[model samples]
Target: MIRLMFLLPILLCLGWYYFLRVNGVPLKQGKRGFIYILAFSTLVLGFFVLMMHLTNPG
Candidate 1:
């Protein structure tokens, strides 16, 4: 689970990169796309952390 949390963002970013490249976006545009992916990944990771915190039966 811990590993997955880290890996998910990387895979998502790679997919985003490929998608942009396939659509003929330039490297500059791809950089911007990466920034967007990073921001979105951060939000997703934060949500997962919050959910984990809420559900832990400590």
Candidate 2:
């Protein structure tokens, strides 16, 4: 789980970049694209962590 937490961000970011490229979103030419990916990945990680904290049964 600890390792997964670290890997999830990279996977999420790459997946987002790929999604954008598939739709022809000019990632290399715009700073905003990178920022959007970073923000999206962070939000997903935050939500994952929050859910883990809330659902711990121990």
| Top lDDT model | 1
User: Candidate 2 — what's its lDDT?
Assistant: 0.74
lDDT of 2 at 20: 75
TM-score of every prediction relative to native: 0.70, 0.56
| TM-score computed on alpha carbons, candidate 1 | 0.70
Which ranges of candidate 2 are over 4 A from the true structure? 8-28
> Candidates' lDDT values, in order?
0.82, 0.74
Per-residue lDDT over 1-58 for candidate 2, one digit per residue giving the tens place of the 0 to 100 score? 6547677667767776788789887767655756876787688778888988999998
Clashing pairs in 2: none
Name the Cα RMSD for model 1: 1.8
Q: Write the per-residue lDDT of candidate 1 for residues 1-58, one digit (tens) a residue.
A: 7658778768878898788779988878678778877888789889888998999999
